[model samples]
Target: MSQAGAKRKLQLSELEELRNDAYASARIYKARTKVFHDKHIVRKSIEPGNKVWLFNSKLKLFPGKLRSRWNSPYQVQTVTPHGAITIFDPKKGKTLQVNGQRLKQYIKDSVPTEGVESVTLADPIYST
Candidate 1:
């Protein structure tokens, strides 16, 4: 019947409209989430002569969770303009170029007694 055909077309249009709305909402949500993530990201500033740790990404198959993935105390030798970093390993006396994203600044621990203070606690009296 003509009425049945009209009803089917209306239902199809409504379904198409719902799909379009869902797609638009998804795009908006993704854009907002990206902005929020970008805002919270801390930028790493690495310079020459600063000590940094290198992240090893090669161990993928059987990487032990307890083992540290970062190789520490590598001195930064040079920083290229295109974000490439050259680091020197004192133990091996070798220099290698790597991506800047894999490096994080290494902060040396200060003297153990510098910020530590002795604390004294009094015994509590028991009351019935």
Candidate 2:
């Protein structure tokens, strides 16, 4: 084959296949390392069934369990497309409608772990 012929050898289908493979790999990676701040995670509009941390405005209503930064992770059951998300509260065993802006995605460290914050690394040493 001539040099010019070889230069244009790649078919359009090959290019599309490569793109699809890349997309699939990225989806898998996202599903695995979903460890990031809420802002980054919930950026491109959220969908129902996605897990998110419901923020607590009132300190009194907030659980005194352990993680005390300001968040409670809950599974989303409904999304309002532009307004709200209905979250399922495992503790209450019921779903509650809440505004999206008040929610945060849960993170393990650098923020606080769920209910395990108070019983921290220091507890092992100072236990009575």
Q: Estimate each model's TM-score.
A: 0.58, 0.42
Which ranges of candidate 1 are over 4 A from the true structure? 55-70, 77-86, 93-102, 107-128
Model 2 global lDDT (CA atoms, 0 to 1): 0.73
- List per-prediction Cα lDDT, in the order shown: 0.91, 0.73
Model 1 scores what on Cα lDDT? Answer: 0.91
Among these predicted structures, which one has the highest lDDT? 1
- Model 2 misplaced regions, further than 4 Å: 1-44, 60-69, 107-128
Per-residue lDDT of model 2, residues 1-128, tens digit only: 68666665666568889999999999988976775543375453557777787656776665577757555678888888666788897877888998888776654568556666454455455557
lDDT of 2 at 26: 100
Residue-level lDDT of model 1, residues 19-64, one tens digit each, is: 9999999999999999999899767789899999999897666679
